[model samples]
Target: QAIYNIRNNPPQEDGACKLCNHQTIQRADETEEAITNRLEIYNQKTAPLIGYYEKEGLLKNFLSLIASDTIAEIKKSLKV
Candidate 1:
């Protein structure tokens, strides 16, 4: 789930280190303030935009703790 979120919603700027197997982790030279700013924007804006759908009763919250059972639960929740 964590990987999925990170990949689907990457940072505003695309950056990767040459030595780290092209990993998405921010480069060491980047300042801490840059990371904080990105997180703040995500928290203050991006997160809440998607949350609106959940608030409108059109979203399902799966139990991430039960990985194997998530699909079944989501299916049952959205039963037709």
Candidate 2:
């Protein structure tokens, strides 16, 4: 979704990497098609790993981390 958003409506020249906090510059030559292809490849590679962890009941959903206390939630989940 993020990539698609960028592809369609790219950021102004002042975007930054969320993780590294570094300035980001979109390549002028990169196309939406290229980004979509890359995203598909990423999904294909990661889907099986995600499924494996889920099947083993080892996948810990951290999606609620922003709304709840992170440490407390992690501890509570670990107790089970």
Candidate 3:
């Protein structure tokens, strides 16, 4: 769906999708080690918070889904 949106929408004046193009350059230049380091840092930061939430019975787990269905599933899970 995101790909479809990108294909159908007109590009900005710079010939890029402002929302999507921002990450392309940085991601393209990132090395595997950099990606792994980032993930390790992220996990270290979030693991304790996730554990706290779980202890408080505030953590909700959901299966991962395709991008197109994620919003719908989240809304449904939230009963919104």
TM-score of each: 0.47, 0.47, 0.45
Off by over 4 Å in 2: 1-30, 65-68, 75-80
lDDT of candidate 3 over 1-80, digit per residue (tens): 12213346544656554667642222332556887888898899977899899999988776665865777787887899
Model 2, 20-66: lDDT tens digits are: 55666656547678878888988999778988999999998765536
What's the lDDT for candidate 3?
Answer: 0.65
Which residue pairs does candidate 2 place in steric collision? Answer: none
Model 1, 41-62: lDDT tens digits are 8999888967798879776667
Candidate 1, superposed: residue stretches over 4 Å from native:
1-31, 78-80
Clashes of each: 0, 0, 0
The C-alpha lDDT values of all candidates are 0.63, 0.69, 0.65
Superposed Cα deviation of residue 28, candidate 3 (Å): 7.0
Shift in Å, residue 29, candidate 2: 7.7
* Clash count (model 2, backbone only): 0
- Whichever of 1 and 3 has more lDDT, that candidate is 3
